[model samples]
Target: MNTPADRATRVQDIVTVFLLSITAVLTAWCGFESSKWGGEMSIAFSQASSARVQAAAAAGEARDARQFDLQIYTQWVVATADEREQLAAYVEDRFPERLKVAFDAWVDGGMAEDSPLVVDAYVAPGDAEAADLTARADGKFQEALENNQRGDNYSLLTVMFALVLFLGAMSQRDITRWVSRTLLGLGVVVALVGIGLLTTFPIKI
Candidate 1:
């Protein structure tokens, strides 16, 4: 009862179903990984920025406060020295510890990020090394941002592929048309859920 065109259509429909299934699964997995990766990248940058700010604040407070007098301001000088040491430890140790894992993860995934080592930033101020590290961090943040965007795109494509497959699988009859439309609607809803996650999940560095 089937013509050549009908047979070809049926074969194409089968292929569509397989492609859609594969794409849908991949999209879901990729989207989840992207979200988690972006969040970790953002946290790393934020902690670095905080460490930098704390160091600068300590330096500025030491410079402005009186340190020559030992009568009443001796406590201030001691506090300033303590603050400087704390700042050094934070930049050289704490920040690096926080970012080491995320940086390694990115690199192992065949992507690289700015080093979190704060040796130059703390040991030698106003140098090229500090500038380079900051610039590298910004680049890494942008890379993570792009990855998140790519995830959204892939998810949308998967939904479109699913709709095409559903339509191809349906007959031209009224009941089949209704079923196809329902499936397409569900696809759209799932895709929108993905979009919501893409926007809401924190990626800001």
Candidate 2:
């Protein structure tokens, strides 16, 4: 103490208690934030998994549709001239609603059996919709991954807050003045940083 006393004064003891309490509060806050982030990450992961499954199913359906169209085209190729005209008319009539715009354009431009209207990416009406689903599913997965990373950040801060608590406990000793000061300073700095992170992170709670 500056009062020529070897023992700590009342003000020093109060300061020590205040610092210890701050560390404890910050530790709890960080722990809560970490838990909230983890829960949110879990929810995000669940949504992503669901979307992925849906995308896979839609892709399979699109493949099946493509196969059906290809089969019809194959049958048309082996038919007689009269049968060929009838089959072609049937094929044109059965063309997908989603593909009508392109099919009409192809007709206007002189319809060909090998045109891109059927051979391109969207073989069926749902194929284009399925591709859109795949893109949306991928976006959900990316969002989930970002949430997982932010959860990990909160977990790291939880550890840092725990360390602050440990350092605070260590500071309450009859060590050398510099050693005590070092421990206290470390605890305060870590607590401040932990609180900052908990507030700024995407974890709402």
Compared with the true structure, all predictions reach lDDT values of 0.49, 0.68
Q: TM-score of each candidate?
A: 0.37, 0.78
RMSD of 1: 16.9
Write model 2 residue lDDT over 64-113, tens digit each, in one string. 76676556545544553457788677776775664545556655666664
What TM-score would candidate 1 get against the native? 0.37
Clashing pairs in 1: none
Q: Could you tally the backbone clashes for each prediction?
A: 0, 0
- Tell me the spans in candidate 2 whose CA falls farther than 4 Å from its real position: 1-8, 80-103, 111-113, 119-123
Q: Which digits, one per residue and each the tens of the lDDT, describe model 1 over residues 1-205?
A: 9999778657645654654565467456555655665565566657567555655555554433222112122343354467876644444343233243443454465543332122222222223344555565566556656655654564555455455445434532346545654654555455556556555544423
Candidate 2 root-mean-square deviation in Å = 3.4
